[model samples]
Target chain A: MRIVVLTGGIGGARFLRGVRAYAAADGAAVTAVVNVGDDAIMHGLRICPDLDSVLYTLGGGADPERGWGRAGESWTVADELAAYGAEPQWFSLGDRDLATHLVRTTMLNAGYPLSAVAAALSRRWKPGVDLLPATDQRLETHVVVEDGDGQRAIHFQEWWVRHRAQLAARRFVFVGADQAEPAPGVCEALAAADVVLIAPSNPVVSIAPVLAVPGLREAVVAGPAPVVGVSPIIDGTPVRGMADKCLAAVGAQCSAAGVGALYGARSAGGLLDAWLVDEVDADAAVPGVAVHPVPLWMTDDDATEAMVRAALRAAQSR
Target chain B: MRIVVLTGGIGGARFLRGVRAYAAADGAAVTAVVNVGDDAIMHGLRICPDLDSVLYTLGGGADPERGWGRAGESWTVADELAAYGAEPQWFSLGDRDLATHLVRTTMLNAGYPLSAVAAALSRRWKPGVDLLPATDQRLETHVVVEDGDGQRAIHFQEWWVRHRAQLAARRFVFVGADQAEPAPGVCEALAAADVVLIAPSNPVVSIAPVLAVPGLREAVVAGPAPVVGVSPIIDGTPVRGMADKCLAAVGAQCSAAGVGALYGARSAGGLLDAWLVDEVDADAAVPGVAVHPVPLWMTDDDATEAMVRAALRAAQSR
Candidate 1:
């Protein structure tokens, strides 16, 4: 069987671990269409936070304690950059992490597309799943917010990392989405998939921006396979990150049922055939969509595989 | 009084320390016209080895044992880059040093001239001497050598760092020197100089590239300031680095007198008004140039100051 997953960074990376474990047992092939909206250039280094998180996590190089970046990462570059007083000192690029950016930036500047660069980097990581960026072109998520003065759009990193998502965001804008095309193998993976699973990642900034890539949303809704989403929210709270703040920006409720209804039913011109939620939200409901409630805490690989099994079952039930 | 010095990397950096100490005691201002020939872009970073050497050395951050890079440096970036199988692995960039390059590359890409970038960086280092790149343009030293098949020119960094200057070099090419102009402060500093000292750096790749800038050599020769060069060779051997190999490339003898004569006399369309050599080469002769015998070993700041004192006395005598 072929399984295609739509994912973001950390949260989605943890979920992919489960998918990989399940696929290993089932002898199935997995392909991840990772979100690239979090990518940005800092200090002339192109940083793909989502892509790197997935690569490091799946390749067994990620820091389990930090939930992002490499294990035993050093901050020599970050500390030195700060000493030089280079602006945007808020986001720290660790020395180990900086190497990936250096190689990626050098290759990208030399005229390689993001997809090609991703492939080249993965050769070293050996990430189990075939990883592909949602789009090779620039498509960053910018948050529109009113801060001190007036409403203006800022890059998602500035909103999330620099401001701590404190400013009440009016909406999220997917910059360059209109012109972006799906990266190589993305559309093909979606078309050939036995099931399409939307990982438990921040929907507004992560899954939403991936869908905003022109024909990507259309492709998922019209494809011949079932699309199932695992809710990033449980008991009206995000498992991690500020998914609640992102949901509020889009006027979506911070609940399993709310996010389920947001994705809506693929049958009703939306992106989901089924929505998997935690057993705590078993009573939650989304009209015209199948809801599967199960234990969703991915405390370990075994626990996560159970969640993946529930997702696959929900896809089949639809 | 203002003293101007033309220099290269490590050896020049050490020599500048002595000049700084001597100038501090004499209450004189020093301007350094640093060579840009050793500068190159590696892994998308604009690495200015000569500029950084002087900055770190004068700023008291250079590794005394290594004779290069920052003291107490870490190699996380280098190790990670090696893991990714990045090319040109022979030249290692320390993590602390990489930060300097990032800031420089970013500013350079953002349209700031390298001279402006150096001044900005100096704000952090506070290198006592007024530092100026020989030229703000892309004037790199490339060595012509036969690699198995035919003769071709490779960057000086590759020849020095990667190959250890083992290849028999035929000649040195100062790429972009013909069209290059002196950096903003270089000509002004030289014009106002009371005296000029050529540091005991490699004459071919180091000092030569600085003079290759159009009209710069003319400025030093025709200006009222006397120019004195310290011999890189002592007892027919260079104090440090491969000055002998480089001297051979241009078919010059590896002796104090040979190098002194190579600079000739400022009145004879060449560089020096006086040449300072070690006591071992007290009888070393340059027909048109005055030669002074002195101890040239820079064991410490005091010893280096003595060498600088000798250079200043030579300048005064002429």
Candidate 2:
């Protein structure tokens, strides 16, 4: 079976681990079209946080406790940068993580596209699934917020990491989404997909920006494949990160029901065919979209694999 | 008295430490005109090896044993870059050192000239002397060598570090030298100097590249300051680095006498008014230049200070 998954952030990395595990057992091919809204150049290094999370997790190098970055990462470089008072003091850039950025920045400056650089980096971490960026073009998520500057837009990383999303965001803007197209291999993967799973990531900033790529959403919705979206929100809170803050910026209720409606039924000019939520939110509903409830705590690989299995079953219910 | 010393490489760094110590006692303000020949962009980071050596040495951050880079530095980034199979694996890129390059590269990309970047970086080190690049423009020392591919030019670092100078160099080309002018403040420093000390660096690759700047050599020779050159060679060999190979590439004998004549008397249209050699080369002669001999070994700061004092005394003898 050909499976195409949309992934971003730490939550998506955990979800992809489950997908990889399930695909291994089913002898299925998995292609992960990763979000690039979080990618930014800082201190002359191009950093792709989402792609690195997936690479580290699937390649057996992720810190199990932190749920991101390398398992044995050091912070010598970051500390040195801080000592020099280089800006953005909030980033948790590790020494090993910096190596990835240095290589990526060099390649990108050499005129290689983001997708090609991702593929080159993947050679070191064989992340099982074929990793493709949502778009090769620059599409950044910037948050508009009221600050001392009085209504200014800041890059998503500054809003998410630097500010910890404490400052109330008015809205999220995908800077270049209108001009971006699905990167090479993205449309082909979606067209050939037997099942397209939208891994539980921030719907507003992560999945939205990926789908915002001009033709990406159309390809997934128009393709002859079931689009199953696992809820990033369990009950009324996110398992990780500040999805509540993000969802609030877009004026959506932070619940499985709200997310299901956000990624509405394809029959109603939306994206998802089926929406999977936790058992506690079994009453969640979206018109024209099949909603199913499953035990959704991804405590370990085995538990995540079971979650993936349940989500796939929900795909058939639609 | 105002002092302007030309410095490059590790040898020049050691020499400047002495100059700094001597100037502190004499209450003379010193400005160091440092070479930029060893500069290169690697992994998208601008690296000025000579400037770094001076910074680390004067800032009390240098590894005494290695005579270069930061003390107590780690190689997590370098090792990680190598694991990714990134090019130019021969660099001794420490985690701490990478921070400096990151800051420098970012500033350079932002359109700041090399001289301004040097001063900005000096704010952290407070190297106790004004650090000026020989030229703000791009002027690098490239060595033409006979490889299996026949005569080809490669970066000076590639020759010195990667090949360990095993490749016989045909000649040294100062790339971008013809169009380059002295960096801001360099000509002013030279014109105001009471004495100009040529630091004991590789005369060919190090000091020559700095002089290769269009009007730089003319400024020193024409200015009222007495220019005293300290021979890099002691007892017919360089104290450090491959000065012999470089000297041979320029078709000059690797001896104190040969070097003194190379930088012949200013009266004879050459750089030096006086040449200071080791006691072993006391008899070394340059027709119109005053040659003075002293124990030239930089065993420690005190020994280096004594040597500097001796070179300053030789300036009056001219």
Off by over 4 Å in 2: none
- Candidate No. with top DockQ: 1
lDDT by residue for model 1 (B193-255), tens = 999999999898899999999988888888779999999999999999989999998989999
Stretches of candidate 1 above 4 Å error? none
Q: What would the DockQ be for model 1? A: 0.96
Cα TM-score per model: 0.99, 0.98
Fnat of each candidate = 1.00, 0.90
- In terms of lDDT, which candidate is strongest? 1
Q: State the lDDT of candidate 2 residue by residue for B103-141, as single tens digits.
A: 998899999999999998899998999999999998999
Q: Per-prediction DockQ, in order?
A: 0.96, 0.88
Candidate 1 pairs with clashing backbones? none
